[model samples]
Target: MKLKIIAPIAAACLAAVPGAVAQADNTNFISRPLSLLDCLNIALRHNASILEAQRDLKASQGIVIQTRAVALPQLSVNGQYKDTERTAIESFGPPASSGGPAFSISPPVQNWNGDVQLVQAIYSGGRLAAAWQAAGVTRKQAAAQYDTAVAGALLDTRLAYYDVLLANQQITVQEASVTLLQKELEDQQNRYQAGTVPHFNVLRAEVALANEQPALIQARNNFRIAKNNLANLLGYNLPRDIWEDVPLNLSGSLDDRPCPVNLPDAIRQALAHRTELTALRETERLRQLNVVNARSGYKPDVSVFAGYGWKNSQFVDPGDLAYTLHGWNAGAQVSWDIFDGWLTRGKVVQAQALYKKSQISLADEARQIELQVRTAYSQFVEAGEVLDSQKKVQEEAEEALREAEARATAGTGTQLDVL
Candidate 1:
């Protein structure tokens, strides 16, 4: 019984041992080597910032549609009703109850009227046109903003992907170095036992191995963090995989691209393409319309109107009966704002100031775009140079290690010397 229980317990412990678990197949995580373009595509599809920008662009397009519809006819319904208990009237004849008949005698009167009417703006001096133009500008601006968002997301994905690749590469290098150092340590130990090498050789090898461990640990940490970062970039809740190689081949010299465009062209393109700038320009146009609308207060608004109505009055006498009267009226109406409180003038001034501010903002935004372009290009150039240098250095280190191993196998080098 004791033997049986001990065997079962041992089996259970072995079964509980930790091991690598298989991941779910639903995970579309990027595990294989991914190119920069692939990473950019992933970011564009999944990045939250890009999604938000897309939403904003959509909203802006909707606003454009709404503003454009301003040119169309507007329809509305209106109704009103009222009741009164007492009333007074003015009589041009004798007083009520004096010598006049009952019909002629003045009495409390009841009146009620109801009608449905429609009003539409026939014309405004270029206000609708300006508004529609502004909306179009806004739509264009939104498209530009979406482009900017895509570029930004792509750049970020590239940086994150490269970081992970670099970290993993460093981890591989450190692990290889650790293996070489371990083999050196073993060889030094054997040589010391044979009195062919000093004990310090073994100690040095061990120290190198220990130092490589710390570097390996740091690299693995960096790799994990980078993986998590990339997962976040892809809008994943968990990091199921990580691409561990630099996709860009860095085997060539870092040479600048020829005939780079100037800052003015960059700025011009940004002004022409940037959505925010275009949006501001549109806003400025809208402000101009606002100024026109404000100034419109000074002008007389003339309108033509026509309406028909019917009313019936009833009495209590047997001979009396309710009679219906129909009336139709048509006339021209005019509203002349001979004087106000300078409100229109104030609004016009405010609109002018806002428009001027928007112009300044547009100029500033152009300058900002120039700076962003310069910065992005500069970073691209620097990364290329650094990557090239690192690649060369890594290659040299690998070659040196290979040579060191070959010499060690030939028995012409001490263990420490080989390391």
Candidate 2:
């Protein structure tokens, strides 16, 4: 019988050895307590998802720069060196009078050319402007996505933190239950020795204490698991023992404060403040700009270009190089894609279709947000009511336990009553 009880107890203690060792190994680190905001900050800085979102936002900004650069003046310098075999050039124009021989000339054997060219887009039929604006909108969308990531991380941290707190409270309640059961067992054993209660009473008390022990053990394990989960959300590695030893000191209870926002107000706030909605709006605007840019393909684009260059047979010109064998040219160009198998028309149609899709998506997202807000508000209210009723139940249970103990001490109650 002794081995039967001791075996399970021993197994439970052994199962808890790793956590105890972890706590002992980092006693000093475990002494500090983390607040909810501290966990949020840590997650924002180190969480992999949040970091990925930040990187995407940076890439979008780079794209904006790339698109805007198309409208700016472009300048380039180029140089060429050529080594050629000499060749004779002949010209005959109706046997130039005497017709002695056809005129012949030998060209230079080596040549060099260098030029600096500048091109400025005087007009692009709004293509460049629309593209740049679309890029800007995309950047804003990325920013909104990043905000959404942060908000999600914050919410996860809050939930995990509260979970750990809730687990701790449960452990406390289980431990208290175990303590009361032990005391009642002691009283029943004393009464059995005095012949006031039968041996059955002692056996019943022992069974209740045994049951409470396992419950308390399970609660402690759950508390450890909850803490580990919270640590993960705060970007700590569980295997590395970074937060394995840290004791969480949550300051408040789960339902300590009532939610002040009502259903309608909550929905209104979510619609106005939600980053998902903001991102969808920006995406819609970007798609609208894309339609404008596609239509721009039908219009003519105007641009001007100028180049200054020096070309000579020798690498260095010795006499009046600026005036001799130097060239400068400037010209303006106009280009219009009159037809391309209806390609521009196809592109405009595609963009318009995507724009319409985004409009529908935006409306759907707003509905989802409203649903989430209402569901959360209702749950919050229900939880508060449940907590109040549970508190009352707890008080009544405590009073009943007190009265049972008093009756037992006065020899007016049976051991079954206390149990």
Candidate 3:
């Protein structure tokens, strides 16, 4: 009866074995071997944040064009027609009876006029120049912001890729443990049948084997979740049926490279190379230009304008058309905003406040970046040490397991010892 009860449990455990082994043969889907650089490249192209940053940079370039337009000449042409029902005249001195001043006037029923005008700014205090400078600085800020976005995306992709690799390794480790327990269970059963060990040994081995099943299941689940997350990061919408189809292999190991040893040097490098700080500095420059622009209101603006036009009683030139009645005019003018309810003063105050705010923000960002650099350097060093220690432990465990199996097969060790 004991044998009968144990047979089905053993069969069930063996049935679970094929799943771990047959995963190697299930290759009906896409397979890609990706290195860290490969993943970074793919993310740079498809990541939503990076694409949005590129668009923002293009928008900043457009603003530069708009601001520069103030320094360029503007031209316009217009035409109009008018019809009159009657002509009337008023005399102030005398009428026809007095014969002092009298006149009869006839006016055309329809008139046409066309005009072309050009205006160019000769000077606007320093407003136009400062505005253009601010726009250029803003464009540079956008470029720097885009670089920061790319760096952030690259870091996130690296972490996700490492997660997938780690999960795959865990699955391998769990499978090995399950296999060892399965073998020990079988040996215990053989010894029980030979009447050389207690039935309790068989039960103990079965319990140990069963305990590994839950861990194996958990490891496989973790691996699948990790792969799915990576696929999402790569902008893939894979279906459940195709989960096993996409096989990913990483081309490198985490411990293959040496960590940076000098923490102070790393922090300095981060501060110098980080795009976020560059963007903040550019923002400060832009705010300074804004203050200059606001102060420009105190000075006068100078401009030159010219207009040429033609007018006639008829829409088309008459057959007799003497001169076409064309005229032209040109002049330069300067205008000062003597008073405007203290608006310029208010604008200057606002700009100064914003500039001060940017200064504080830049300082805060520098401190945060320094902290991040130090933390990352410390973690990198610690991880390298932990990896070395884990490798040694793995090697020792394998050797011990091998010796326990050899002694069990020679009937010189108990099943518990092998386990």
TM-score of each: 0.67, 0.80, 0.79
lDDT of 3 by residue, 203-238 (tens): 999999999999989888888887776666665556
The digit string of per-residue lDDT tens for model 2 on 45-65 reads 767778788898888888888
What C-alpha lDDT do the candidate models reach, one value each? 0.60, 0.72, 0.72
Model 2 misplaced stretches (Cα beyond 4 Å): 1-31, 85-99, 192-199, 237-255, 313-324
Give the alpha carbon lDDT tens digit for every residue of 1-419 in model 1.
11211111121121111222223222343444445555556567778889898899888878888877756544443343334344444324455678675343332255444444444444454556566676766676677667767656655665566566677677888888788778888978897899977788889888878877888888887877776776677655543353542122211121223333344555456557555566666666666766776676677665555566654443333122245455765556677667888877887889889878878887886676656655654554566578679879989988877787777768775565566
TM-score of 3: 0.79
Question: Which segments of candidate 3 are over 4 A away from where they belong?
Answer: 1-32, 82-109, 193-203, 237-255, 313-324, 406-419
In every candidate, how many clashes are there? 1, 0, 1
Off by over 4 Å in 1: 1-45, 65-72, 81-96, 103-113, 123-126, 158-163, 193-195, 239-340, 402-419
lDDT of 2: 0.72
Q: What's the distance in Å from true for residue 139, model 1?
A: 2.7
Q: All predictions: root-mean-square deviation over Cα? A: 13.8, 10.0, 11.4
- Report residue 343 deviation for candidate 2 (angstroms): 2.7
Worst 10 residues of 1 by lDDT: 8-17
